[model samples]
Target chain A: MKENKCCCSKKQKKLKVVNIGLQTFAESLRAQGVTVAQVNWRPPRKLDSEMKNILDDLL
Target chain B: MPVKKVTVQQNRYADSVTLMGILDAVKKSGKVMLAEVQMGTPQNVEVMRKLGFDIPATVNANDLVIALEAQTNELLDEAYKDVIDRLDRKHTDGEETFNSIDEVDPADGWNLCQISLPGEYAAEEAKKAINKGLDVFIFSDNVSIDEELQLKRLGDEKDVLVMGPDCGVGMLDGVALATMSLVREGPVGIVGASGSGAQEVACIVEKAGSGISALIGTGGRDLYPQIGGLSMIKGIKRLCEDDQTKVIVLVSKLADRAVMDKVLTFADGVKKPVVAIFLGADESLFASHKVHGTFSLEGAALKALELCGISCKDFEISDEKIKGIVDSYMKKFSPQQKYLRGVYCGGTFAEESLIYLKEHNPDSQLYFNMATKYARKLDSHLKSQCHTLVDLGSEEFTIDAPHPVFDPELRLKRFRQEAQDPETAVILLDFITAPGVHEDPISPFAKACAEAIKARGGALAVIASICGSVNDPQDIVKCGKELVDAGVILTGSNHQSTLLASAFMKALDNRK
Candidate 1:
């Protein structure tokens, strides 16, 4: 529900990140009442660029 | 108790002219403390012996240098290790009474297993994990494909998951109990060919207002030609099939193009858009629902978000965006330039530069080395290029050393020679910075680059990519500011540097 101005322009918008990280990060998300899902998989085979994007989406 | 002179310039002695007179004065001085003298440089050490001073038998110049560096590194390792060791001990010590199935029973706590056991023993390790009903993380890389296939199957049968055979880094939930950051609850699934690659990707995602579903380190083996992404395919498929995953991004330092093609083919069928970034791949061949061609490791992360429709508020200042903007800007700067001379620290970035140039002007000769042992070893299409992807790691260029990251002086000198040549119009450089990186990377890199640009009289636009960690105290932004201030427009990552340098060539062609 928090709002901030967009960097692209000056329009204000809600800040959001669904759930991020494991325990503490998850707890923070839950405190904000964000729904969380546990994903079971090995880390990405490519660890540099694309991996971060996937992580960003999850957040 | 005497401190050794390690500086480049030798300490000044009074102009008494005689070495003995200086030694006599040294001995006469009430402040002279005779503990041990550490002779620093090979040149200085030789001069010291000629002066007839009885240098210690134990303190040779090489030994002193080695000891100093090793001691410093050892101390740092110990400090970080102390943190990890204490945390791991606490997690282990508390496990006797902790509750919950998702959580490791405090009694059965801290199953930190080394994965280098022989095949039979490895199977036994998997069996033990199942018997204890523990979550397994594997960190060894020498295990064969067959061994991995067996171990993975066993974990599945036991209804528990195994992390890696060569896996070193992952964050399970939010407990960075094992790795530095342990685990946080986020939606990103990270896969990498290199261990450091995984670590870097995770750090960036964390910095950019996101977290990870899981950060998987597949050891370098999964991307090698023999395995061809089979395990990686499994890992990716699992993430993509998961209802929790909104996006899957793949990162790797190096991979076979054919294997990458197969992975992409599979990716094309996924409901979630995949961001496939293959390092050193020609941009012309990038084919995916959402493909990002990047040379440096960080570019893949930025492009993945862009492809996923999650625009960063500051993507403009992000490394990739900056490189794109600067490349376009440079394209406008010089419209008549033809040939380019690129000096890059990273091997993969160098190849991408050549690829970008060819795309712009196929007729203009592009020179670099992609050093594959034989012609038949390479795909026919890749064989046509003369640009050598000179692995700075190889002993040929990395003479008298184990690491290329430590020594950039050799390449900087060669870059200067290339700049003086009349045919060279532009210089592209891939400069990287990170912890335990080259000494004075920004200044030395900028100095060499400025010299080249000045020699060409502003015709040469030096484009650079800073590949250091975002969390690094001295990250790419600071490095870029320094480079930009020095008259060289620093691109964010290697991919952008290549693209911008190539775009400049394209702009030149349009003028002609």
Candidate 2:
């Protein structure tokens, strides 16, 4: 993280974002001029696991 | 002289990517000078070929067409394969892979985490993110009071902000965090407990030539004694301390007495002026609380703007203007055309219309779906009464298909149904333009409304408001003009549209 002072004496923080759900939320962050990486989250399920494996194999 | 035109079509459907490649290939190949590679069905190819004859006898059109057609066929085959191969090699899951917030920081580099996981997993995810020392904006609903309390406390320990588990709208430093309008950067900072309420305030403030410093949406239940107005309190403090914020505005429907008391005490301590909207609460509630209280969302926005030395008078609808339109529409409406039907694309739009209409004309009863959040007490929402409003975005309407905002087909069908009804003298609608929304949303409904009007002997009044700015990609001006050209009375704002709608209904109701 690059060195940036806190806006207040509250906390030191960076501006990068991890959007861990809805694509809509991530899109908003990007629109707002934030560096956001959206996590493609799905429930931990057998079907998702199988789908993930298939997706992994596709690579 | 030679005429040139390149028309290409895949034996199968060529996706946009493949079509673009074919154009690029033709562009890179200097042989086809001034060539335009078009991707279309075989029908378009036949049309192109027929149009090729019009290139004038002075030019060798036949030779150019023959060469271009051959080149196009070759490019189509190669381009199609390249697209298919590229897509085959790409794994979407692999591209989006990240199991935990911990893996995100050093790799992807994000200091803030917006959590929208299910309520059950929300607290855990928030804790993990907070421990990683990131500000959290939670958009998850159904989170328990205990879980929310725990998550927020953890965020405090980490010395960062925790917005909400049900918060849907927030804008920090010109970035609309979740559900919000494209508000500009300015001095009025907002902290609201209602998503739609905050959105209305932000949008109205933006439209009034002023702008927002920030808009923080605390979750709907943040003011409950159990949750204890945690985020709202934090939001106020943050806005008060921020150098950019010249004024602070607070909006909420339900404020527990104890929480409101505590919040008022807190607001009194802040130096910046505060505008508070407690929907059902009296203005006297803030008399001793060091705040200005307004009842409605529109009033809240106007009040906030006023504190910062701006006046917003557009929400007020003049009776003369209302009377002229009412009388004009009243003349065309037949005896059978009596009822008013509103089909809204958004939940907030529907509620605002209903609230405005009810406040203006107390006798105008409205029926809404049971799925709406407006009635927390819950009506059998199964059926609608005479003057009904349906939020097309409600779960009941969006169960199988996409929300009508993206796909207006469902809303169009409903509009047609209402328009065809003999009693539907007025058909009210809302058009929202945002990124990812259907570009030409109004034209379909415009055609639908026109047809319905024709069926009704050209008597139905279509009143609508477009909820968008020109900055949005939907080309709202052109789209709104389309609605107007189709004989829709398009209002400048949702509040104006509601007044017009209610005025028409009241005038019609009085006649009966």
Candidate 3:
């Protein structure tokens, strides 16, 4: 809890964000004049262990 | 027809939109055993697993995009194909993809990140954002206490603020975040572990003609011994040090005993004036220090305002006023109608309404289809007791459907069910407005109530309270008008609505 560790963005600078999983929250951030990049996020497919291990190594 | 399962990549649509789509697909594409569709977010996959889909615990964001359990593999495959085709068309309309947070760093000085994924995956995602150096505000509910602790501990280690997993509402620097109301910006900053409490104080501050400097949500569990009130502590420090915020307000409707004292001790350590509202219970612990603790939401707002050198009248519902409304509605109840049925979208308001009702009749028979610490739970959420409350946003209701607060469609059928009951004298509702929820929740709700009353010979008293600021997309004032137009009695706040209902019930008893 340091004095300098504050996020009152009004006293600081513009608050940019990368929004994931929820779209509306990101949109709300945008409406408030913040820069936001929304990622169309989805979990990885439920690959079987064999496929998962292969994909894990391949990636 | 054999049950077949399919998994696909999640769509970019809002969770409600995608859920509604899957349900619609199920209804239309008949002979379906099961049709649950959601992004591979850890939370959603878990839900799909509960619906008997074979989704595992280790599912990742990029893994099985969507999973479906249907009658036949052939039929479900077709359904999955059709949905993916439609969603792909919807999402790929010239959209760029970011593999991870590291790839698409927002150049606008990415200060904070808001994660609304399911709690199962929320912490992992939050850690990723924190590692990349960003403060986190999580709107996702049901995150485990251990996971929340881990996230906050990591946040502390990284000098990041982790807001909520089931965080209710929030506003920072005058911008409305997930599940929050807008207040005029001024000198005071707020840190709330409860959404409804924070919104109430903020709205009162606005009405008192004072304004807020910042409004923060420290996720509900932040005050627990395990979490150690980390987010609220951080929020207090940030607000106190910030040059813009002169007064700091802390709100939590419920918190553990050990944790409560810890918060008070911390607040006392701060120099700025603080108004602490641990509502439904009173504490005189902070009367001497720059901290002031109160019981009611209005008192908290007034105290905060008073600290800012402003005086405001309490918007309490007087006995005479409650009696007046009760007297007016007394004549409308039929001889057989003797119960008050409450259907709410917010858990806090549902409990608040129940608290007021119990105060009116301590022996009253109240039941609810919710996870409440104070009241008895109904045998079935579908069944109603004498005085019943239903939190329609419960995990059970939203497992494969949209939230009633966000989509009124799920609650539409309950109106018919309750209205048809001969004993249902009153039907109470909480209409909410914010991002992600439907635009006109009250209008359709009003229509349903009107239809039910009309069908049941107009014996029922439909009462409602709309929670949100006028700045919301579904304006409360406008929705209140719609409710009034539909012959529904609209109260000002959730607490006021409860008092009105309680008084009306008392009047009914007196008529005997």
Candidate 1 structure, TM-score to reference: 0.53
Ten-residue segment with the worst summed lDDT in candidate 1 chain A? A1-10
Q: How well is candidate 1 docked (DockQ)?
A: 0.02
Q: List lDDT for all candidates, in order.
A: 0.48, 0.68, 0.73
Model 3, B333-357: lDDT tens digits are 7788888888888777777777667
Stretch of 10 with least lDDT, candidate 3 chain B: B8-17
Fnat of all models, as shown: 0.00, 0.36, 0.45
DockQ of each: 0.02, 0.23, 0.35
lDDT string, candidate 2, B10-104, tens digits: 22222233335555765464444343333343543455556552232322211112114224545544544543454333224243445566676
Which structure among the candidates has the greatest DockQ? Answer: 3
Count of clashing residue pairs in every prediction: 49, 3, 21
Once model 1 is optimally superposed onto the true structure by TM-score, how far is the C-alpha of residue B435 displaced, in angstroms? 3.4
> Against the true structure, what is model 2's DockQ?
0.23
Docking class of 2: incorrect
